[model samples]
Target: MAHDHGHDHASSTRTRLAIAFAIIAVVLVVEVFGAWLSGSLALLADAGHMASDAIGLLVALVASVWATRPATDRHTFGFRRLEVLAALFNGVLLTVVAVVVAIEAVRRLTEADPHAPDGIPMLVVAGIGLLANVAAYLVLRGGDRRSMNMRGATLEVLGDLFGSIAAVVAGVVLLTTGFAAADAIASLVIAALIVPRAALLLRDVVRVLTESAPRETDVTLIREHLLETPEVVAVHDVHVWAITSGAPVFSAHVECEEAVFAEGRAGSMLERLGECLRGHFDVEHSTFQLEPAGHSEREEPAHR
Candidate 1:
């Protein structure tokens, strides 16, 4: 039943990504034309962001599909980790787009005969792009937010959302007040919105790649929980890490009572420990090696 629900959820997420990808593609076309017609750097930046988003969505779509491939002898964990790689790419790509836009905005601001954005076209096109971005954002927002791939995609749309707003504001300001710097400033605003979020996502991607435990997981608490079992005298080499977003893997070496080892009761004790891990920590996959007391003396100290 759990496996079926997970499959259904992935299917639904993929469908949502498809819908968002379509919206972004259409928005990119409209925004590109709009940017050209109005000479607004803000609109151009938004268009560039949308282009990156289109590619990101494609990567995410492929990752999501690849993640479902059955495990093979060569790759025991299957391709599920590809989703994290997709998210990593998205984060880096978004950061590059923002930096590029910021540099261009600064150059435009310094130009002696900088083109003043045409407010009528900027307003009309930005309005259209804004609506399209809203639709895309809403579509992606419905996906599994816990998944890094989905979070990256959703963040891209959110950047687009804020970019659209900046452009809209720039348009209104330029149209009503003839503020020549509004377009460049709006472009900078769009860049600003993307960098921080991209940095945060990159941090998460790195955490998973490095096999660090999930940020919210407490190794100490996990140790305490294991020690709660009377037969389990001590636990060491406790390691926990997330494969992607919600999928965490755990392993530990447990020091057990001499009787538990000698009396052939380790099997039942192992079940109890596994249940504790799953029930209390939400860890579905775990491996434990039972050892007699003081057995770890022969082993080197673990990284923990």
Candidate 2:
């Protein structure tokens, strides 16, 4: 629960995401029109992919807004988890997009279609798309990349940007040399580039959804740091996890010598422990139970 996100940062992210969504939507409409005018199935397919990116951006925008809601009784963590889910959804979408592009590239390589789209129009439309994708990518690039939602949205925009580049390359080759295979080759290359990044994003998303500790935290190291404090006899039941990206939570039970408790030094120990977590581990939300040594031995077993 060490959520360091301030209202200003959240507000900024939401504004940029909204701008990206708007840019992508405008590009999608333009692509659809270009697809109709040229009757190029390739342009139409690209438009479909752009539409998917728009959806992904929209999802990220909505999730960001929801994550800002105040905590409730039923959901004390609020809706921050939605950002992780949106990121997972966007990751899956990116994988599907890469697979689809690969399959289409193979299709074009294996079979020749007689549509014979006008390369001039294709080039013009792709140029516009390339510019639009660039704008959207830059807007999202300003947001928090560590945030799963923002990262996912940024990846989608980046994928669209790659598509626009591939299209531009294909259009140039087709118009200049009438080499149709250029389109398929460009698509294959783009797909190859997208897969690795998509895999990395999905892996990060899975880490959060599975309740894994933040990558930066070292539980063993944290325990040793706690032990270094004076009068701390032992520590146990240590737990660490994240509510979302950049927000780590920690908890443990600290056993002190009986004299330390008798002297009523629990408050000072707790303050020192809290500072340790904040200063060393970058954890702001933590819970600790102060107990005398050997206290845990008298506790009942779980569910017994």
Per-candidate TM-score against the hidden true structure: 0.97, 0.90
lDDT of 2 by residue, 76-175 (tens): 9899989988888877877787788788778778885634567888889989999999999999898997788898888877877887888888788889
Task: Report the number of backbone clashes for model 2.
Answer: 0
Q: TM-score: which candidate is best?
A: 1
Q: Which stretches of candidate 2 lie above 4 Å from their native place?
A: 1-5, 39-42, 112-116, 296-304
Task: Quote the lDDT for 34 in model 2.
Answer: 89
Candidate 1, 1-304: lDDT as tens digits: 9989989999999999999999899889999999999888999999999999999999999999999888999989999999999999999999999999999999999999888999999999999889988998999998998899999999989988989999999999999999889999999999999999899999999999999999989999999989989888889988899989999999999999899978899999989998998999999899999999888887876434
lDDT of each: 0.92, 0.83
Give the residue spans of candidate 1 off by over 4 A.
301-304
Worst 10-residue stretch by lDDT in candidate 1?
Answer: 295-304
